[model samples]
Target: MSKKGKKPADSPATERPRPIASTVAPPPARSAPVTSASSPPTAPPKPTQAAPPDALIWFDKRVKITLGVFVGIFLLFVLFKWHYISLPAWNEILPDGGPAKRGLVAGTPKRIRMDDYAVGAPWILSNANTGFKTENEAVGGLKTPLLTLPVKHPIIIFKIGYWGFMFLDVERGYSWMYNSSPLILLLGTFLFFLLVSKNQYWLSLTGALTLFLSSGTVRWSFIPSSMIGYCGLAFVGAVYLLRSTNPKVYIPVAFGLIWIIVSFAITLYPPYQIPMAYLFIFLLIGYVLNERKLVFPPKSVLVKLISLAGALLVAGFVAYLFKSDVDETVKAVSGTVYPGKRSETGGTGFIANWYSEYYSWFFDDQQFPKGWLNICELSHYLNFVPVVSPLAIALFAFTRRIDWMLVGAMAFVVLMWLWMEVGYPEAIAKATLMSMVPTRRGQIPMGVGGIVLLFLYLAALRNVSLSDLKQAIPVWFTPVAIVGIVAFVVYTAYVNINDAEGMLRTDQTFMPVLFFILMNGLLLFSLNIRYRMALFCGGIILFLLPNLKANPLSKGLTPLTENLVYQNVKTLVDKDPDARWIVNGSQFVTYMVTATGAKQITGVKYIPNRKQIFSVLDPTMKRDSAYNRYAHVTFQTYINGAQGDTTILAQQYEDGYVIAGDPCSPKFKKLNVKYMLYDHAPQIPYEVRCMKKAVELGSMTIYERID
Candidate 1:
């Protein structure tokens, strides 16, 4: 034993104090036996300090100014090109009359109405009373809801106009929102990057451009739900990534972002947003592990949990507001339509061929008769960028330097896509949440994941060394997998005889070749990482350019409001303000007439009545056909051609258009078809038919019906 007064080397005075909670007391000192010729006292450990904020790395002053200038220029350019600044008359905004083609309508001068007309028609035409109204068969009405339900997604196009263009008149507001939706995407990307990157202007700019220029974005640019859904996903990612050493700053921001996430989630379109939701969830988990070791210090945990609870409550309330409508829409869309079931004899289910044609993005001259009419929404449109970023992610994973949360998020998306394609059992798909989203929409999440991983890969590379590269390179399985991808693509192409039969377009043959080149570029970079980023950047730019220019930016000046037929129809509606009408020959004509303050028996809507609205126009259509299943007016034309159907042939209605049949009919009088608008004088079965020629405006002929 040591002398009574002598203290031990490992005694309290010589020992390091453990970090303690404020409520806990320190232990009382204790004496210990002395050791031989003494070792030096050990030093106390330094208290841990959080790392400097990572978001600061991107906040360069010059980058902000440059991005601002570029954005201002872009906005000004679009404004001038689209004639939005000076403002055209509402009548000149969008064309109303044009010739119809098979599988095409002349809504706009060019046949670009897949979005400009089809989805946007209701908004531009202001079909306020178009949804499920009373069952009035006198006007060719039905007992069932005319619309599917929860009209929010379809009406979002109109809402954008209603809210965003408050400065302009009603018609122009819709026209503006329809044409300038790309700006919304750009704005969302900027806000997202600003929050996540801490105003890292360059990164924000790149990401915004990447997302905005993506083929899916370009294809869905006119559809507000698509862009709005993307904005929600971006908001989620931004909020998830926010963190700071200072709790005061980050904690409040975190709470606020949580609320934002809840709002965004409630507004989500399952097709695009579900995958992104899962992706951000993984990213959030990863961020926690990387930054906080999955343990937010006790105080932080309490605040985050409270915030989450509050957000969920708010989201629940919001969802309840539209829950009924959404449920009905879900049921209707899942029925026998393009993306729906087929006949019992087993023709291809409406959207099954489109799903099978997923590989069009890989082919140069690929065609998708049933896919997004814009031709840019194919999964592979981003070319090698999607393929290569995942490789980089895998490389980092192999070396154990990867942030697995990010990896897990991306891996889940790939798995979900595969799950859908291979026809896994529903139990498995549902368990994995793959069945919740449409198979076609998987591209959106995969595209987002690819971009996120690209940013992650770049960040990882910044601190990596040659030794790290050496360590990561030996993971030969990644390269082997890439080879396997190439082989599978070639074998599939050969087996399908896509080469000789030209079933697959050969125009884009360079894409698969480009994938190899990108892979080679990555290999080249392992030797030296400093300069090859430009090559990859160039490759990305090349992939983006085609889709970016899919529609003319200058066309924004030429609105969809203008047309010879709209003016004529408006005049007719002005004469008899109380009557409802129907148009024959063209859906665009119907939309134009609707825009002129007329009620339509049918027009373009996201979910048209499924219980055979076409049967109202042609009684024979009560029997099921493509028209009833598709619930589109254009399907009537096809059915008319296919079956030589004369049920509607020569049938005359007062809204405008007389078939070769008898004009004086009790059905026409009961329907209150006051005026018939047609391209030519129709054959009157008898002179006693109380139909008088009203006016002839060029190719359009108006006939007033007096029973």
Candidate 2:
């Protein structure tokens, strides 16, 4: 019906109010153009993403591939050298040698005894005798609480077996187990340079030489902890280098590295583990932050991080099967042993020295006649020149020419050193949930970081010209160099003059100090000339020269398997396989007896069990004295022959060792010490008659118990 007043259906009002006249007009329709039907329909433009940066292309593809192949070959060479290639050298070292060839030097008791129990001997012995259980005889008859855990670096143990088995014939009593540690380090150093030096083969070679030949690396060459640390660092370098190649490969490579690093870390004690974990985290974070300018991490990066965290958690759980072992070690070490007691310079000595010694930088050789300082920790300074890396880092940072990655590395070095040397870092560590961390282990990172920083500094200097040096030194380079040289010279002169007049017989201080000064001077000159390559080569030379003289075989191990004392002890052990024995001689004698499969009344390396000590010692044994300090059921033994004297006999009783002169004593019987070897025998018929004679070898007289 047509009704405007009633809004008829045909009217404008009824026709949806003229479509409400849109305020925002619709897009104008295109006019129909006179085009042919043959024209193709236009396609829509495709969405695109920003291309990844190529700023990381430091090496040519050909060079990278060649070096990678070389690395593979080198690795193979090392493995072959460890196995088949060792034959020529073996034959040359000992003519007509069968399986029984000369092995590497017997190092300190920690290396000879503790390391063998931890990873070396157990692996060799287990493989040698199929029925031999490592768990039952780890570090002697008494079990090491830590070794019971799954975290004993089985990867390292397996690696040792794979590469060391051919040459290390346990049946023939070959003791070249520790020799592989140095070789591993050498391989690791090469890998580190290959990854980090950006295909600069010369730099890589120089760096490898500098690191492998460093006194610290040499001195602690026998320790798997140090070796593991180096390997972890090499993998870290690989991860850093590979992340830039392709994102598709980055995730898997990074994760793979995490697995390897964590595996290496978990196999050993905490000293190496904590630092490596920290380095991985730091490098990952720094890389992500530096690569992506975005403040917040992307979802992909977040996912990778979460995955890493989960993997690390799983690894940690697997490495330490039970947390109780770690806890027990913490509890024990915090009590009255060498770890807990006041050292020579007070407070746990150099081993657990919470405070760094002021003179640590000066000590290179700690061997008897050649060393100025006898401190073990100070050996880390071998061939290390005093150039103040922090100062250089600070200068670069202020100039804003420094890469953040290197800055982070240097920061780690400084942080680790401070953690080891100063009180504050350890205080913070203890205050946090990481209270169980042995702060001494921080030195691993310190050593590694220092080495890395040295390389980075040299790498940075490689590009600097004389003009750049002139501009960078800020008009004070020459005067500063002169002053530094003169100051060091004057300091050395004063030290030498004072030392010559002191109680020391021969003045060994001047030569080292002079060498140090000369090295610093040469480095400073190289800085002036921008000859970093020369300086690095000189550094290698400086590090290699002093430590070239091999570590003298640990006393009493001139010939490791065929020593006279070891043979005598082995005979007695072979007779009564079940009976325990005590050696009234040096720690080396104890080591020899233990190596021969004899169950020692007291352990050769570690502290003995407290309960065992209490069972054998007098009831009046003081809790705070040396007797208590030297007592444990595990590894504590007489350090040397201290028979006849009351205190020494008391110490022997406390340590669970038999009193040499009194084999018939109640304590000896209680401990079941069925045999004794007296190196410094007291000529008394009463004492001699108490035990049945079992032949004398050299200064030692073997005896069988006759109650």
Which of the numbered candidates is closest to the native, going by highest TM-score?
A: 1
lDDT of 2: 0.45
The list of candidate 1 runs beyond 4 A from truth reads 1-113, 128-162, 179-181, 187-204, 222-268, 301-319, 323-380, 383-398, 430-433, 436-438, 468-520, 523-525, 554-560, 605-630, 634-664, 685-688
How well does model 1 score by local distance difference test? 0.45
Give the Å error, residue 508, model 1.
Answer: 9.0
**Candidate 1 vs. true structure, TM-score:** 0.67
Q: For residues 1-707, what per-residue lDDT tens digits would candidate 1 score against the true structure?
A: 12233332322223232111111122454455455567666555433222233232232344456557655764554344342111122233333344221112112222333345433443344433233232222122232222322133432322333343435444344445544455555655555544433333445566667766665565554343334434534444344434443455454555555544554544435555666667666765665555463235534556656655665566556556545545655465555344443111111112322222224343332354434333444432233344444565655555565555446556754654454355456666566555655555566665566566565444344335555456557656655755755664454434334433454554454455445445444533245655554555555555566654444333332233345666666677777765655554455555556555565554443433434333344565443334333333421221233544233532122122223223344544555667656544443335225767676766566667766
| 276-334: candidate 2 lDDT, tens digit per residue | 55654564454444445432333356545655676557656655643444555445554
lDDT of 1 at 17: 24
RMSD of each: 12.0, 16.0
Instruction: Compute each candidate's TM-score over C-alphas.
Output: 0.67, 0.64
RMSD of 1: 12.0
